[model samples]
Target: MAETRVKSFVLRFLLAQPLTYWKLLKYIDVDIPTVQKTLKNLLRNKILEYKNNLFYLTSKGREEAKDLGISVFNSAMCPECHGKTVTLSPFKWLVKEFESLTFERPKAISEYDQGYVDSTDTVARVIFMYQLGDIEGKNIILLGDDDLTSLALLASGFPKQVTVLEIDQRILNFIEKKAALKGWNNLEVIRYDVREPLPDQFKGKYDVFLTDPVETIGGLRLFLSRCVEALKGEGSIGYFGLTHLEASRQKWWNIQKDILEMGFTITDIVRGFHTYLLERDDILNLELKVVKEAPVEIKIPEVDFYTSNLFRIYAVNSPQPLVRGKVDWQRELYYDQEAYVTCP
Candidate 1:
């Protein structure tokens, strides 16, 4: 089953671009040895040609892909920026429309657990959610709203109700004030922490839940478990952001396994989907611009490297057993060696 899945994925991906082994490794979820064997099989079958360490589909492979009803060549490829991960190709129009939306940026405070993507990314996310049939009249709950996603959903006149469960009072206040200013009575904000049990009023009340959780294993588990508690039974959808930078393949493997064990199956992983805005007082922003000369003269790279992949998971059944009792909130969330950034 895994081999068949890998074969179909490779055939579909080759229609997008010629792939190097390393690039394929980054994107595919399978083990390297398995990928090697699959590549060998395709090569032996005269389906692929590997040159300069990059893999390309042969004529036979293209014909096979066509027979399977997959488009072998794309005429709409962007000539200037010709890659999936970096270029905002299919989403460019939506992102441009999102540029006009406005929201207050949350202050970077680890204590309040406040870190957010900008309005553009939030709109991009909202658009994706809408595309997935989560539009107007469905009940949606936001596990956290540092990004003010509830406001975005409300502004679009979609969703029957937008409930937010947040630990930060500032965010709660801001969302309420903005929602009122827009005269959107459907938006609701509640102060709640994932470390504690989900409120009775919220349990099994939502059609969907959206979050961008802390990448720590415990943190993610706690956050998502709460989402499951809030979600309605089977077919309820969940959306969250997970990054390759902070979570290694091993961590991703473990997280995905845990999610499936809890009855949600991953449906889509849109790569490089979340882009963060740099703020003036952002710690990394300040560090990036500073020129340091001590044992070495070093300057930060002139590029925005911060991003997260959008993961959409579907509930296969009512959420599995809930993690009873309050989680230890003081647990070391960022101490893991796989943590990409240092945090207090």
Candidate 2:
């Protein structure tokens, strides 16, 4: 059972050292209730004890884990990033490649268009896809590439073809220029909106699709539906980012249901995988407005704080096709008052 396996993993980690509930939630991608239930069960069985704001395995828990063997921790490893938010070894090459590329940073568009994560995270995203065997001669499409992930993917010299569909003309043009300069002939860009049905020629043409979608139910559904339309049948994989800061558990459940109903099975979720920088021009000013009381001068954030967990879903059956035609980009798809706050 998934629940049993999760509890065992937590026990194994406790064998090494006590962990706070917050760290467990932030690093482990399992549902909150599931984690809580597992902790409760372990406590009830006298296999775990809590003290000093940490959870530790009791003597019985240690004995049970010994019976299970130390190797059990292996299964607990995050399938997406391969380790628990641990940066990959040999990652410097990816970082170097990312740093070499240059582009102008655009102002965040009133919470309608979320800003991209730093280049390192963009490169890391591509690397994770590659590590999962989703690259090399596969047709990959980015439903949205505000992060310029396509560049990193192409720079890695994997994937037979890479396509980017973006609504922002500025991003489209920038990608086009950089691609040409790099002589990435296999890379292509088109000005397209996710609210619109996927172009006929693009449908059922990709082995993988990647995006960081708007978190609302309608928004996530529309974006994911378009990506599913563009994927080749079973075994096709899609990757995207979702965050707890914006999406509640109920919203996640609805989105997961939509994915399964459309014929996908979520394979892996790496929590806090993508980190976004909060530059003054990007999000610092916007975030300051949302607080109840505004300070005269807000100091810049030292750390890159905003983050989203990565989800990898595989097409378990033929992708359900939606009617092919233009669909209006309703305000509900991009703007939900509950999900966003912007200064007038």
Candidate 3:
């Protein structure tokens, strides 16, 4: 469904204008058969309506076209659709992915999301992987993300192999079926506990690694140590740090200092924020820590939003442009790949 991101554009275009199938076929560079088939499916589902050889959305379809994801878009900025209204989706929406979990009917999506907690630190850690030195075709091991494990793997568009290490057999078994449902091929899930230790086959065998192990300060260092041990000589690592549980930000700072001691250089430390919160929380100010002494530059293009919240980290084990000085992705901060000396 996510193939090429073409569907969204196609659907949105068609909904905005009522044109005949033939006209649309010739106007859009898409396959006629594909467009026709999609039209039929959407029409049948009342997602669209057509008459007089021209297409138009039914009332239900019109409502569906108005859907948007929760983001930092300021309604005030968009003079067209701006309002502080809440009604558990008092109006029905055409899109339905959040399903029983969309929180449309919750106390406050933004606030509840802010107040609601993620038991596992899955999404946070995966976002950190992109900032690592070219995560492309790298092997990944996610300890326990449940459904989130798969989404993160695909979103990266990199990583040669992603091994989901889980503690529960039932969840691990369930992931197989879930992967099939999603039609993802490059991801694999492993049932294992971080408490034991990474197996011999995993030692020093990966380029980059990430994990959102069960949160508890007592065992966190141990979990991170295993992640670092798995990386190559200069490989980097990233993970989520849930700050709500603790009053002190020492865990985040101490870990950065300790990781550098072990040899991994620290780069970007993106802050974490609520995807959907119960009330208005400053998304920008949410980023409460120094995520990076300098930005990390990878061969791939990237987008990072979590750098706007409570302290979380994305540190690396190598020395180069990261330690020498400030980083600018479009321009080199240093010439030598091995040293972080200031560039002319």
Give per-residue CA lDDT, model 1, range 193-260, as digits (tens): 78788888988888998988887787788888888888888999899998765576778988998799
Please report how far candidate 2 places residue 336 from its true position, in Å: 2.5
For model 1, the superposed segments whose C-alpha errors exceed 4 Å read: 1-103, 110-113, 278-281, 284-297
TM-scores of the candidates in the order shown? 0.69, 0.71, 0.44
Candidate 1 positional error at 78, Å: 5.5
Query: Could you list the CA RMSD of all candidates, in the order they appear?
Result: 9.4, 7.8, 20.9
Among all candidates shown, the one with the greatest lDDT: 2
lDDT of each: 0.70, 0.73, 0.42
* True-structure lDDT of candidate 1: 0.70
Per-residue lDDT for 1-344 in model 3, tens only? 42122244445556657655433433343322344456556667786666665666666665655663212212232232111111223222211322322223223222111232231223333433443444577776655544344444554456777667666675566556555666768777777655565777766666555554322333345556666666665544554433322212344465556556656655544333322221223322233111111111111111212211222333444422112112232212111121111111
